[model samples]
Target: MKRLRRVDRTQFQKLTYPHLEFLYNMALKYCGNTYDAEDVLQETMYRAYRNFHQLRDEAKCKPWLFAILRTTFLREQRSLKKRPLLDDGSGYLKHVVDQDRKSLGALLEEKMDKANVQQLLEMMPEKHKSPLILYYMEDMTYREIADLLDIPIGTVMSRLARAKKQMKKNLLKKLGMHKKKRNFSIISVFLPGGGL
Candidate 1:
């Protein structure tokens, strides 16, 4: 077996250490607990260090690390019979509902909390949920998500569009504000003294 040299080890650490926090948080999102998350992260680092020479681009380090974490988490999940579902504490909720992202309608600034958003993510199908978690929670771009998930760019776009729609519809229903009519307006989300 080819052993990693000292310089290679240092280079690997330099490239991969900066993303430790991101990897851990994402691991938590996937595993839903500290123990499994730690296991997956440790394995990811182990695999990355062993295969550091295979990484072609330093600029793609984040996506590469993300992909490793995902695969490692999946392997860990398979070994365990049962696991709790994930919850994210990311600030994506603030950006999604209340921010200038006019593609999705505006809602009560305080209505959409992390729990509500995380619940919505939990309810989504994994294929769709993965993109949203990567994009909103991790602040990764569509391209990065596509690369990490090994899907086409168009697929990433479509999945995110559908995920957002699902989130909106579910939130509206949960908030007791679902309307059967077409052309849902941004102002429809705003309610006085009531939050999502």
Candidate 2:
């Protein structure tokens, strides 16, 4: 590993450390578990440290960190492709409670549950989920999201639109509220009260 000089380390810390919480939350959403989120965060930090010299603009640090986090998550997912799903023993009860929570009509509280929201994200396709998470969780602009994901701005908008649609569908289905196909503006699932 390349060692960071004192000056470089300080500058890197100044630019990056403040965003650790943001990174951690994003990682948690991406990994869907604390353990894997921690692993992803560690890997992201190590990679950032090693490649700190490559950063061209300090103002772009947040988006740069996001890029690293997103790539690291995609890599982790690829590596775990063959891993079998282990039953966590939280059987139908968990689903029942989740449904109840949704039906309670407190949109903010129901959406604020991290685990529940993360579970919903995990059910989404990665393409849609990426933009959905970036836009909703990070408050990133479509341009920024496009750059981070290496896709066009239009693509980001479309993915977000589709992501929102798919999330509403999935959420309604989970809450046993899906009756017919209609355009419902249920964006609260992605945005709790204001942000994640």
lDDT of each: 0.70, 0.75
lDDT of 1 by residue, 45-163 (tens): 99998888889999999999999889888787675535434445763322222232222211322336656666766788999888866775566787898899999999998998777
lDDT of 2 by residue, 1-196 (tens): 2454878889989999999999999997776446778999999999999999999999999999999999998998886665555555874222222321232223434345766777778899999988887776666778999999999999998998787677777777776668955544454433433221
Candidate number of the best TM-score = 2
Best by lDDT: 2
TM-score of each: 0.41, 0.44
Q: Which stretches of candidate 2 lie over 4 Å from their true place?
A: 1-4, 82-196
Lowest lDDT 10-mer window, candidate 1? 97-106
